[model samples]
Target: MAKKKQTLFECQHCGEQSVKWLGKCPSCGGWDSFIELNQAEQESLKYLSKQTSSDKQKAMPITKIEEDDVVRFSSNNTEFDLVMGGGIVPGSLTLIGGSPGVGKSTLLLKIAGNLAKSGKKVLYVSGEESAGQIKLRATRLDANEENLYLLPEISLEAIQNEMLRENYEAVIIDSIQTMYSDKLTSAPGSVTQVREITFELMRKAKESRIAMFIIGHITKDGSIAGPRVLEHMVDTVLYFEGEQSKEIRMLRGFKNRFGSTSEIGIFEMTANGLESAKNISNRFFSSSKEQSGSCLTVTAEGSRALILEVQALVSHSTNPNPKRSATGFDTNRLNMLLALLEKKLDLPLNSYDVFINISGGIKIKESSCDLAVIASIISSFRNRPISRESVLIGEVSLTGEIKDVFSMETRLREAISCGIKKAIISTKPKGIVGIKCFEVDEVSKMLELF
Candidate 1:
């Protein structure tokens, strides 16, 4: 007698597994995201997991592993190479994700062209665009190299066949969502198919010891569209974030196995191609005279400190419940700051509508920006501007006390390099030569600013 196959349901949003179908996932609260997976897939997953576990268990002494050096290859782009942790490691799978027209494709093409021109064999595979479409963009970017081979096929078998045909140094699969497997009945970008396809590519990359750069599509929620495991499977994950209307793009490493994550690469999109951004520290602020409701602060993006303009708008709320909104800044942090202002500073802020935004689409999460945020709000409420050439750097306590932050001196120096003269800090340091650092202990003392 044949055994009955068992099936399981997996949530598409959070990859939660369940024995039975659920209207809403108990783990992630996602509605109708569960997909059916037969017993075959479950067994396959177990087999793969066992194989991986066995390899890890066979690990030798740590000193023996450190004796060997990893093979690293540079794509010849400084900014790209820096974000990639010195260079790309062979047998590594990297996923680069970004919104449409944010230059994910462009950046990969440029890297491919550069590698091929430097006598390295590269295969550029595109499932979404034809050879002609890639060629047009390459021509515009002046990226015509003899060793840069282009394949506009989507079949996994065809791609695998090409991999077997030659020992290519690097392979790029543009937009992994467009590739499909014949064994899967679901669509190409479906959760099951994505998992299967990534597994195959990862296995192939490891066996061949070839570096693979796979482009991934982003969901409406700004996360990489696919199973959550897709990110975990890859060796490195990079996010290219920027405004579509603006030319400045920033590439940051969310996960890197080779090097530190405290590195960020900045790029500017020009008509030709993406170029390394110059003077990134000062480019985020406007040039005109300083205005009310806008304050300057320095926040660290990886190791680099940038001068950002924190803008706030406070107006009388017509509704009984005031509206609060924040962009590029945490809304919860804004609310907390507002409550502190009302309780400790004696400001009736709950009755007004407040909005806060960081310039240049740069998200500010450092607690050190708290002083700048509060100052911006107060400036807007009083219709007064602070000192023009000063930058605020401190963490605001819940009791409205100003607290010192890490790397306060580093932030102040960056501001000085951008021609800023004054830095209002929480605690006085040993002091630097160029910028004037003023230490303030409470938020009330800041109300006397011009």
Candidate 2:
């Protein structure tokens, strides 16, 4: 008698398997995430586990390993090279993810073209778009180079074959989710297929010393789609973040084995392609006359300081409980600020609707912007405008005391370089040649600005 075929339902969100269909994934708590897939036998799964031994052999003494053989190449994109901690390391797997149409492909294509121009044999592979389509885009971006090659294929075996035939220095897989292998019976984007494909590419990249760039699709929650295992297997993980409708985009390094994760690359999207955003500080500040509900602040993106505009709108709430909303800022922190305003600052915020926004689509993760947020909210509540020339820089504590922020001089210098005149800081700052500085010891003193 023939052996019975087995089937299992797997959660695409978390890669959990179940004998029966589940309405929601027990592992990841995602609704209706289970997908029925035919199980290939254990013998067939061996291909995914097979490893090559070109680079890693028996463990040797740490000092014996050769360091001069390691190679790094610049893609010729200044901001891209900076965020990547100098340049792309050879034989490394980098996964770049973003929402649909956030310039992930465009940025890679531009890099591929640049690498090709530098006499590095490069192959541009696209599983989603055809060669003709990519050619059209290359022409539009003016990235058509003599050495740049294109391979619009999806099968992993075919891609490897092409790589072996051409011996290219760099290769770009337009997306990892679209690649499939004959070893796995699941769908192309299923957890098994994504994991297997990533493993194959990673091993091949290590063996051949090829700089590999894998474009990944992001889920609705802004995480790279497919199994989280994909992120762990890669050497570097980058995310392109910004509003789709906006002109600016931020390339952030989420995980970097060779560099600092705090580094950020800013880009401006134009009709030609993505260019380095050099004067981004001016972009965040509006040109219109200063008004209430808006305040200026300086933030640090890694080592670089950026001048930002913090805006808030406070009004009487129609509902029983006032609504609190924040964009590009943490909602919980905003709520804490509101409570602090009520208790410590004696502001009646219980019956008001608070809306806060960090202008220019730049998300503020640093706590140094806390005082500036409070100042903007209070400015809106009191209907008084803050001097555009003045910038608030400090952290606000729950006890309502102002706290000093790191790199105070860097933040203020960025503000002064942008032609700002005054700074509202917690501790007294020194060497402020062009700008005037004022020290505010408590949250209550911030109210005296208006």
Candidate 3:
């Protein structure tokens, strides 16, 4: 006698399984999410089918295999290479997430052009744009690749069939949310569908030893859309972050299994294409002078170091309560810092309206930007202009003490490369030669230097 199969309703919004149907899923707390799926069909295959003559697998010994011996495909761009460590590793799946019109497709297209130039076959699968539309954009980007193939389709099974037939060096999927499989009844972009499709792609990438690039959609909160586990399934997760209004788009590496996770690739959006910004420090600060209420700071993102500008303005408020506003920085953190200043230093903030802005439209969350935030607020209060070449890099404690941050050497090196002579750091930074370094333990001590 055959074994009996189980039955349950699955949540479409959160992929939860339920024994009984309810208006809302108990596991995910979502309404009307339960969808019935065949129990036997829903269960993933426990073991791989026996390989016939047609299905061959790579055979290797655990000890005999050398990771360093694996061949790497260079994207042929220095900045991109840095972000991807040495180069693209084989059998790696990378997910690129960003907002709409953040140059996700443009950057990937440029990479495809570069890979094709080096005599590598590239396959670009676009579900969001037509082949003709991609072609026009590629032409504008000056992409003349004879080996690049473009296919406009959203069927996952069809894409898998094509992958089995072609021998491409690199494969790029425009957006993962649009792709779906017929095996699942869920609609495209649904939680069940997105999770299932990404898992299938991961399996394909591993089995074929092919490097795949997946572009993902971001939620309204600026995080990647789909289940939270989607980020963990990929070998590399990159977030293309920057203000929509600014031309600068920062490619930050949130996770990298093949390389360091602290790397960032800087690119500037141009009419022709996305150009790599080499002098990141100069590019961020060269346009600004000794302006009042503006503060310069060196911050770190993963393995990459950066110099950022922090600006604050204080004005008299007509309302009984003063207004506080901040951009690219945390508003609550600003308020806490203000409270610290008011209670500890007895500064005047209740009567004055305070506003803070991080120049270049880049959002900073690292505590290293704390010193710069304080300096900017003080500059506004005193109506003083911080030196144009001066830069601050440190973290601030709740008790008004300066704290040391990580990668001090790297941050200082980046600042020095751009001709920044002075840096206010939490501790004495080492490994950087021939530069002025001021070590301060408290934020108030910084007021005298300014």
Per-residue lDDT for 248-270 in model 1, tens only?
A: 99898989988777778899999
lDDT of each: 0.86, 0.88, 0.82
Instruction: List clashing residue pairs in candidate 3.
Output: 262-302, 262-303
Number of the predicted model whose lDDT against the real structure is largest: 2
Lowest summed lDDT window (length 10), candidate 3: 45-54
Candidate 3 TM-score, C-alpha based:
0.87
User: lDDT tens string, model 3, 43-65?
Assistant: 53122122113345677799998
Alpha-carbon runs more than 4 Å astray in model 1:
38-43, 55-59, 63-66
In model 3, where do residues sit more than 4 Å from their true spots? 1-7, 11-13, 20-69, 286-288, 318-321, 430-434
Pairs clashing within candidate 1: none
Error of 1 at 146 (Å): 1.1
TM match of model 2 to true structure: 0.94
> For model 2, where is the 10-residue window of minimal lDDT?
41-50
Better of 2 and 3 by lDDT: 2
